[model samples]
Target: MIKDIIANTTNIKLTVIIRRALQGVASNNNPYLTLILQDNTGIINARLWDVSATDIEALVAGQVVTISANSLLYNNELQLKINDYQVLSGKEAEKHYQNLVISAPINVEKEWKDLLKTVEDFDDAILKKVVLHLLKQNEKDFTTRPAAVRMHHNVRSGLLWHTATMLKTAKEIVKVYHDREINQDLLYAGVIMHDFGKIWELSSQLITNFTLQGNMQGHIVLGSEQIGLACRTLKINEQEPIILLLQHLVLASHGKYEFGSPVLPKVLEAEILHQLDNLDAKITIIDDALKPLNSGMATNRLLALEGRIFYKHEGEKKKK
Candidate 1:
């Protein structure tokens, strides 16, 4: 698998799904295909040099292909130089497609049931009703969409997995501060709604892209707008304090103006949600980066992490 690859690894044949494929021009005016390849393990950037127009037409994101590549360390990142590739079709495509796509590691049905139970148990009746209403309105998409196109929790049903894990983490935090009078119910609702807009922002569950609205307004704004819709649907006044709080949580979840959400978190729950959101997302990002490195090896600078390199401390066999 990709995680075991090192600088000396060469001439490997890998069956990988193309997560992204872009054609670009080299310095010498030659055209090349820059492909982001993914498997169940992790993702890597690869280059198919000197490609013709037919090659560009033949490749696309989500297409499964078996390729012969020479692995090389470029700028501290392990990347592939594809010498050749063949697209998989029919039974072969079907077989690899099921096993290759990155997915949530939890049982979907169980998570859904548990999530609903937690929401149902909320002490704040109005908050519970609004949250349940929104979830019911978008259950199918919420349960199916990836949290992002190519970042944290960018896998099948990742939104649910991410939200559930964050909720679990928040629940523990609430317990820790049980004596502090923090409104645990508000925290729970805020956590779930923070990334709620991704379901609508992302174009599809498969072969995902940003919707026009998603690109224009972004998920934070898109999600905040939903609070208004939910209020109208639930016959709650938009001016209610809880409604205002939920909207703030949704809009300010990003935590910074440059990050997209211009409004900084004002309420305690919004602040808590922002912190947990970053913790969860960074944890996932680091996990994904470390998965493709050998123990004691360091990854290339990760753009998402502000060009920081991370090291893997233990290997699979060592852990065993």
Candidate 2:
């Protein structure tokens, strides 16, 4: 199994999906390929040195292939040195494809149902209509798609998991700040809509990739545009302050311009949604990084967190 083949494993043959493949030239000017391989268990980096042009051409992302590789530690993380690899075909490829996609840890169906219930229970009629309309329109992909190609919550049904968790967090936060002039309805709606563009941004394949629109427009722009379309479809008043506020929530979700947000969070609700979105995404990254480590060990540098290393304490207790 992919999980069992770790550092020190040598000459192991495995059937895997090519999550990513990039062609490069070595220091000696020899052609090579850097690959991110995946299976149902997890993903790992692999290098193919001195590869032929034909090999480079054939190794496409999302293709199934069998490889013989030696597992070793590089930069404190498990990496594979590919001895040889071949693209699989026919029934062989199909069989491996069925078993190679990883999914969200939570029950997707349950979370989806709970998400719908939350939307339906919203006290604000306009927010309720806007959110429900979008959810219903993209129901299948919304529930099944990964939140990203390869970032926080990038598993099957991860969009649902990420959105649901944010909604739950927003609910608790609004209650604590009940005295503050917070709009609970907007908070809930923003949380649901913040990453809605990812449904169009990413492919729903086993090894997710950016769609053409995703590459060109990204999630923020696409999300904002989506909100605009939904508003127009519902015949929502253009003069309504809520319409602009909702658009701001999606546009400024990244919190700042350098981080890809076209605008910064201007309203209190948008700001809170931005912070909550960052918090949930970061926590998920930390959790995923620590899962493969034993107690008292430090994780390999996390690429998602700017190469920060996290330690797992033996008696560490989760925050309540």
Candidate 3:
């Protein structure tokens, strides 16, 4: 398995899925291929030196392949130095493909049911209808797609896990702010709709990648467009206060223009939704980075977290 391959390993032969493949030019102007490979356990980068055009054509993304390589530490990260590789065929490829796709470590059906219930519990009719409509329409993809290509919650059913955790967190936050002027239903709807476009933005395949729409429009713009369509189908008035506010939540979920948000959060609900979204993503990244480390050890710099290193406290108790 990918997790068991470390710096000391040699003469490694494994069946793995090609997550990504990119062609590059070496210093001497020779063509090479850089591949991101994955199994059910984890992902790693591999370099194939002095590659020909025929080799590049054969190494397609999302295909299963058998490879010979050696593990080595490069810049404090483990990478593979590939000597040779071949795309698998027949029963061997099929068998490896079935086992190589990683998924969320939770019961997807249960989490999906919980998500439906959360939407159903919304007291505002408009909010409830909007959220439920989108979920039901995209349920299959929403329940199975990854939240990202290489960031936090990038595994299968990861979108659901990310949504479920955010919903739970939002519910608690609403209770604390209940005494204030906070609109609980708007918050609920906002939380549910924030990443709704990801269903179309990301592929649900074992090796996830961006769709054409994802690269062109992005999740924030795409999600806002989805909300608008749902509103129109439901006969939601364009002039209604909720319409613009809900769209704002989706548009501003990323919190800033530099972060891909078209606009910064103006309303209180949008601000809260953005904060909660960021908080959950950051926590998940840290948790994932610390998983393989012993207590008191610091994880390698996480690229997603702007190259930040996190430490696992020795005295901190872990959940079962």
Candidate 4:
């Protein structure tokens, strides 16, 4: 199974059909192929050598193809080396592999309505407008964008799920310190809009990838620029209330320089938002990493999640 290919060191002997070909150029070389193939278990990465000149042209993105690959470790991660592959252009491949992808099983419309209801609870009009505008701009992405490329919340509507959870947590904390005069408007806006820039920063295909903007300026600068445009178009007085309300203490959500935040969390609400966002993201990483099994032991090497090792926690046993 494809899951075994990712989990163990056994040579990949399974039959998988290529579902998508991600466009990428090797360092100082011509464009190579990064094929995303799928079996009943999950998707696996298959690297094709010299694909630029081969009949790989027929195997376009979303085209299923038969492949024979050897699994090996690259950069301490499992990767498949495609020895031979062919495009299955006829209707046979579709009937064989259409049910392999494990996508979101919940009702998308219900989740969206629930998200809107959560936002309506906030009593700040300016913050509400900012969020509404962002939602309007990415009506499709908010519901379809993955929270990450390959880590926690990397599913349909995953970004919205994470954002809604953070808002809920922020509300509870903000209520505890009622006298801080902490601008709930700004904090709420920042929490919702912080990663909204990623919608543009990432390519929203089946495989989420960093766009040119993401590779160059990264999400923080891109997000800040987007905020600037929104503020300008809406004619919000950004110098005083708008900047104070919209600006995050740490420019990036991570709260540190290395993680991409231009400014560290300094303001009261910005700091709080940073912590809340971090807490939610990390917990999600652990949750997703441990979701597959029910017992024994498993150590997940989460590169995108945190480049760290994670061990699943066994539930408590009943005392009879």
The candidate scoring highest on lDDT is 2
What are the Cα lDDT values of the candidates?
A: 0.86, 0.87, 0.87, 0.69
lDDT, candidate 3, 180-256, per-residue tens? 77888888788888988898898666678889999898888888888889888999875578878899999999998
What's the CA error at residue 210 for candidate 2, in Å? 2.0
TM-scores of the models, in the order given: 0.90, 0.93, 0.91, 0.71
- For each of the candidates, give the backbone clash count: 0, 0, 0, 0
> lDDT by residue for model 2 over 101-201, one digit each (tens)?
88888887888888889889888888889889999999999988989877788888899899999988998988898899898888888888899999889
Report the lDDT of model 1 for residue 30.
99
Best TM-score among the predictions, by candidate number? 2
Per-residue error at 92 for model 3, in Å? 4.4
Runs of candidate 2 with Cα error greater than 4 angstroms are 303-306, 317-320
User: Model 3 — which ten-residue stretch has the worst lDDT?
Assistant: 288-297
